[model samples]
Target: MALTFLFRFADDVVEASDGSLYFSVASTKFGLHDWFFDVLEANLPHGQLLKYDPALNETSIVLNGLCFANGVALSVDQDYL
Candidate 1:
């Protein structure tokens, strides 16, 4: 089962060992015309990585403006995360 649906355009997600979650918010619009043009379209509202803390049952934005942030991956070492 899922929890919250506050995400606008969740393209990618990553989970940490400490039970923290990170995800990217791209664009919410869909259309070939809108996809090709528009600064916001190219920007795609990327770079905004969100974090979810289960202990507090809260979610917050960590980064913003990632420019079409579509994917995310973490290194083996949790430290890299």
Candidate 2:
């Protein structure tokens, strides 16, 4: 099954070799059109990096408090994000 999440906007997405999905939530308070506003407000880093594991059928927040979680990539060794 596919996992679903609700957020104001989504940015980059990358999949791990182990079948886990890592994605970014651009902002929790604004959409693309309001990107400037979000930047202007500087409102406490409402963005996040999330992870979804199909094997466990669960999703979790890997990181939070990012100014704008816009990118996601795995390390060269594939050992870290």
Best by lDDT: 2
Q: Could you tell me the lDDT of residue 45 within candidate 2?
A: 79
Candidate 1 wrongly placed segments (more than 4 Å): 1-5, 28-40, 43-47
Residues 1-81, candidate 2, lDDT per residue (tens digit)?
655668788888999988999989888788988887777767577788999898998988888788977899999889888
Clashes of each: 3, 0
Task: Report the error of model 1 at residue 38, Å.
Answer: 6.5
lDDT tens per residue, model 1, 22-76: 8766643433345334245663543457788887778886766666556676798
* Candidate 2 lDDT for residue 41: 68
lDDT (0-100) at residue 18 of candidate 2? 88
Cα RMSD to the true fold for all candidates: 5.0, 3.0
Best by TM-score: 2
The 0-to-1 C-alpha lDDT of every candidate, in the order given, reads: 0.63, 0.85
